[model samples]
Target: MPASRDQADRTQRVQLPDETGPVPVSIVHAEPRWFGVPPPLLLFGLAASLFVLALVLLAVGSWPSGLILLGLSALLTAAFLETARRRPGSERMRAAHSWTSSRLELAREHAKRLAEVQGLRGRRAVIESERRS
Candidate 1:
């Protein structure tokens, strides 16, 4: 049976350090082959074209050429599947780690700006009170 779309595409919730506390982030795990392999469109197109060429060769009475092309196409498809199955989980983890780190840095920067603004507001209130006295 084929794997479901949910199984192929997984989402993980990661806790990243922030200025205030740990922040929960949802990270969608994209295709494993996205960064490592050729585009799916290109791979599929090549396989399909090869299959079609094989059929055309067979129609033209070139049995040997047709068989060779068919075998090549099958091998290409199997190689792609094997690559996907053997892809390391470490790559995905690394990508998620980088994404979380960047988000955490942004949160810290925002918190720092907010703290500065609050400090300015407090100073203004003190000045106002002194003037009223």
Candidate 2:
């Protein structure tokens, strides 16, 4: 028996039902199980709020304004300090000093799976867009 044309090509094809057109990109999504808000976002919000308060004081330039800014700044710092009492994530950061984790991992996995998923042969488009950027 003769080998078929597809067998001669040495490549496989798959089909995804919902795909509309070529995507030409890498997409990484978070793990589905965890939905809680990160603590760092809360800390950032507090700092941003304090910065706005300082801006208000800068507009007024009065002694009482200075006092109010100082009081609030102290309070924000103290709140951060209180959270630090748990000594959980901070200790890990201090020990390893590496910041990025799941975000990069997810990006790599998505790139691999996007190429492997049936009918999603958009790897060249993705690579080209990345090169342009």
Return the top candidate by TM-score: 1
Q: Which stretches of model 1 miss by more than 4 angstroms?
A: 1-18, 21-36, 83-133
lDDT of each: 0.69, 0.57
CA RMSD of each candidate after superposition: 30.1, 29.3
- Over the stretch 31-52, how does candidate 1's per-residue lDDT look in tens digits? 5445656643345456668979
In terms of lDDT, model 2 sits at 0.57
TM-score, predicted candidate 1 vs. hidden true structure: 0.37
The TM-score of candidate 2 is 0.30
* lDDT for 9 (candidate 2): 58
User: How close is every model to the real structure, measured as TM-score?
Assistant: 0.37, 0.30
The prediction achieving the highest lDDT against the true structure is 1
